[model samples]
Target chain A: MKTRIDQCLERLRKTRRKAFIAYITAGDPGMAETVDSVVQLAGAGADIVELGVPFSDPLADGRVNQDAATRALAAGATWGRLLKCIEQIRRKSPIPLILYSYLNPLISRGFEKTARQATAAGADGFLIVDLPAEEMEPYSRILGRVGLNNICLVTPTSPSARIRKIAGLASGFVYCVSREGVTGMQKQLASSALGLIRRTRRWTRLPIALGFGISTPEQARAAAREADVVVVGSAIVNRFAAAPKTAAGRKAAAQWTARLVRAVKEV
Target chain B: MPRKRIDTEPDAHGHFGPYGGMFVPETLMAPLQDLEREFRAARRDPSFRRDVEYYLREYVGRPTPLYFAERMTRELGGPRIYLKREDLCHTGAHKINNCIGQCLLARRMGKKRVIAETGAGQHGVATATCAALFGMQCVVYMGKVDMERQALNVFRMRSLGAEVVPVTAGQQTLKEAISEAMRDWVTNVRTTHYVLGTAYGAHPYPVMVRTFQSVIGREARRQILKQEGRLPSALVACVGGGSNAIGLFYPFLQDRGVEMIGVEAGGLGIRSGKHAARFADGRVGVLQGTRTWVLQDSEGQIRLTHSVSAGLDYAAVGPEHALLRDLKRADYSHVTDREAVDAFYTLARWEGILGALESVHAVAWLMKNARRWGKKDLILVNLSGRGDKDVQQVSAWSAKHGGPKA
Candidate 1:
């Protein structure tokens, strides 16, 4: 089944421009702010919005994202609450929303039940950061039954065989991690990322979204040229973090994201 | 259907009957698979066997005594007890056995850098020692709190020229240290080997670490039969990540009559909501690459754990131990921090042996249950480490909690 996520990627493919995806913690600052941010970011030109399900131990995250998760978890974010936030965002925006998480949160409750609730609450799908392809067979079946997409990640360190296997089962889009290491802003992207993207390209017809350490618009522009989509996470999460929680603060955060979103689109 | 043997666990995918598997990022999938393949080859490689044997016998000092603890036995007035002195190993603990085994494998894989995660610092010191011996660069991740709790071992690791990266995430203990180490491994997997310290984590690690640590049980089994003309009726060891305990228990798993017990730190007692006792009401969840019994909230978020002994204060049990518990092959019990402190002094005064606070949980349990046994019963305890590294903490604890009464 083609979720809205598949349709959005299909739409982007028709238009020769790159897809710019923005990532933010689901309940950061507050769920209301998160709901508003999704609408605001979507209006500013995010092709898709990824909402991180704040977990206590974020193994794939760097300091910026980790701190953001801690703050969101402290502000009372749970799988159920994050799903409700998604429902709220769905009211105002049709931006394809994906849940970014570690396996514990989804599997911690019950896998099928929690996933059903996520899809029922209007989520397109979720990307469990720590779930390997070896462990995803059952999960893939579950996600498929619910009519939701299971986004797959391709790492720079992923071998050729593993990349093919991961790409084979992937739905919606294939996420290509820009380098080795956790998520954060980095000074330079690894050269291996290009090779990884090229290698992954041979196996899947799905759109490839490049992420990890993509902060600056210049870096976003460079990344956008290589893959079908560009993902900017920690840097975007950081922008709202430094601002106060007032209405003015929220608008300023949107304005800042809009500028970066425009730069990636221009590529 | 034939009853499955305990040793043939995790099958090909590393699942110990729906428990251990490689639950990691894609970046780590290939590295873990490579490690599993190399480990299988190294097991049959005669050169690998020779190097491990040579180092265990000469460098790490193997065949440590299985001593008859006459005074401790008499004090108990019940079981005639014996101690497997893993404390006598070169690094003052049983951790070196696995480190030597893994570091040698790292060299065989042509990886010149190694990374590890430590709590109570024993594994960190052991890894650093091996890195120095093998001429490899070493980096260890430790929780900020653990560095203060196990300061002596931290100093020992630095002295051996390993960089100790302080992890400040979450509760800042063993769990966070492991997460940080995993992140480091994912980033540098091409050049580094993550020497997971215990019989936990992914498929190959649980199986691999248990194999290396099985030396403790092997020696104890051989020594006990020769000394007493029979196998001991029971085996007891401390359970943190369940390495030393599994080390002692694995060799005896086939001996159906020999009872096995694993003691855990009760911390202020399980009722207080401040302990590391997973089996009390454990939830099966994934953490640090393994699916095992974890201490987590209803939402599956890992919870902060506490134990007076830093090493035992972890959120999850080893997957093999989880399977053993499920199979009812072993019994797990807990001892409070106060009892562990009392047991430390009692054992030292009676037997002149000061086990690590982590290992002394076994002694603590034995002391509590001393009246239950008789002289006809034989019990062998794996004293996993010496308490020299714990002296300062012990002194401060005694000063605050009051000195042990005679």
Candidate 2:
């Protein structure tokens, strides 16, 4: 009787290893590379892949992620195209996919329709970077019915009571926003994420995935040692953003994703 | 319609919604947080409010008069028009209304410098006036194009002892000036207060600014009741960051019969795909601060907008205005660049007083809709600022009318 998200979490727990959460911006530079990167992450040992859907004003993001989103948006990334890329990746890969976005896109796309389309495209869950639990009922209702989990973000600043409330609504796993700023490749993970993990433990038994500043293999190793899942986004998106928009560029980016995924998955 | 308790994110500190939050590099976050904490305490102190109000009334010119435009009303042969005369304030516009309040807050927070972004240069002049009054270091970031268009105001700010930093990045316009001001704020968060010209941006700001500017609508409502015995049938104003429109609309928002109309600059035309009509063409998104409607592409890049008036050409509309539109409390519309220019000239000829090009968009709608209203019906427009700064553009407009053959 386990939900798809609960099953995903159980799978991660039984492995008892750090679940590699490979993060890449959806349609950075181009859609073709985005599809290739997702597949490569799955093939190379990423337990779960977080596909960042770019927004114009990512208030929560740091500078690096903001630049990546601006580049992707400038190159013609759209929701329809991003969904199409997810559909293409699902055709051949069974990687647990989570679409990460801000509130505006979901509201604009009509919450019910977007949830249905996301489920149809094989997306397992969603993490709306800005929509907190207090304002989540409208969106959570539609997502709940479609068997797609709504991932909640618990920041270092969130009170223990707020953490429990957020965890009560979350299904897949609780995404611990490891630090204050937006998602970016950082040299060091704040020790604060450990404290947040310990605090959230009081709220629910859901697995906690640490994100928002994890960059290198060493940082990933540290985060993995503490939490059930280690999320890496800006570093992978940087590779895709820097690569040229061509067949060769996508191949190179995929190779890059494979290398990062390998580091996080080591037993 | 259940009202959920509004919550604030810890990382946001003092920012409102998504629009008003701290986004400085790692080094400046602590100082920004300190400034915000101090501002919070100072804001609650009654003595601080009394001191600021004393200065606002005696110095910055609070409670500007409400004038009924009988001549224009008779000529239009329909609705009577009234103007909340914000242009008569000390700095010649509503811009100074918030500047005085921020200068006081900056002094209490112990900040010694003031920086601002200017498009029409009205805000720069207003900020410069406060800096001179407070003897603080004032640096105004103005786009090169605006600096050229409003050269006299540039000279005016310098005369007031403020340095004008001409910005030439991105589009060479107001949008670029804002980007540069943000960069400046990031570098100097400890000693600088970005006197945002409108009611937008992170959390406390939208609320703080609206509170400061609310005096306009407050005074207008009382004056209208005393002079005309009831509120007007419609309220009209031009919206850039929407401060003036908000100033005129806030007190009347609950009045079921009062209609609020915000006129956006439609550049050439909305259908021509070039205008500053965020509500007309933009999707709901977050920008600068607060969740609002913005002119952005699918990937969330803020797009460059065009308008004949420098002050009205912003890619994002204010967050409160977005909420009002969503609730159907106000009607948002557009006026073409050509129509605005014609209205600007007509107003000068019809009335002895000239108006800023930014406010002419609203005047254009008034001219178009005047015939539809009955003789006794009334409309109140926020006559935001004077047109003296627009001589160069207006001279060229006049030359085209009579001076030379093209």
| Consecutive 10-residue window with the lowest summed lDDT within model 2 chain A | A56-65
* Tens-digit per-residue lDDT, A134-162, candidate 2: 45777787788988888888876566777
Give the 10-residue window scoring lowest on summed lDDT in candidate 1 chain B: B1-10
Q: How close to the true structure is residue A188 of candidate 2, measured as C-alpha lDDT? A: 78
TM-score of each: 0.98, 0.78
Classify candidate 1 by CAPRI docking class.
Answer: high
Q: What is the lDDT of residue A221 in candidate 1?
A: 81
Computed on alpha carbons, the lDDT of every model, listed in order, comes to: 0.89, 0.77
Which candidate leads the pack in DockQ?
1
Q: List the residue pairs that clash in candidate 1.
A: B10-B15, B78-B374
lDDT of 2 at B48: 79
The digit string of per-residue lDDT tens for model 2 on B1-406 reads 7544323222334433434443232323344445567667877999878977887799977788898887788788889998778888887888888888888888887888999989999999999999999889999999898899889999999999999999765466777677667667754565688888887665456666676788888899999999999989999999988888888888787786889999998987877778899988988765654567788765455677888788898888877777677667789999987787777777777776678888878888999988777888889988888888876786776576443211
lDDT of 1 by residue, B1-406 (tens): 7665666367887998879998888888878888999999999999899999999999999989999999999978989899999999999999999999999999999999999999989999999999999999999999999999889999999999999999988899999999899889888889999999999888799999999999999999999989998988889999999999999999999887788999987999999878899998578999888899899999888888889899899989999888888888999999989989898899899999888999999998988886677788889999999999888888888888896742
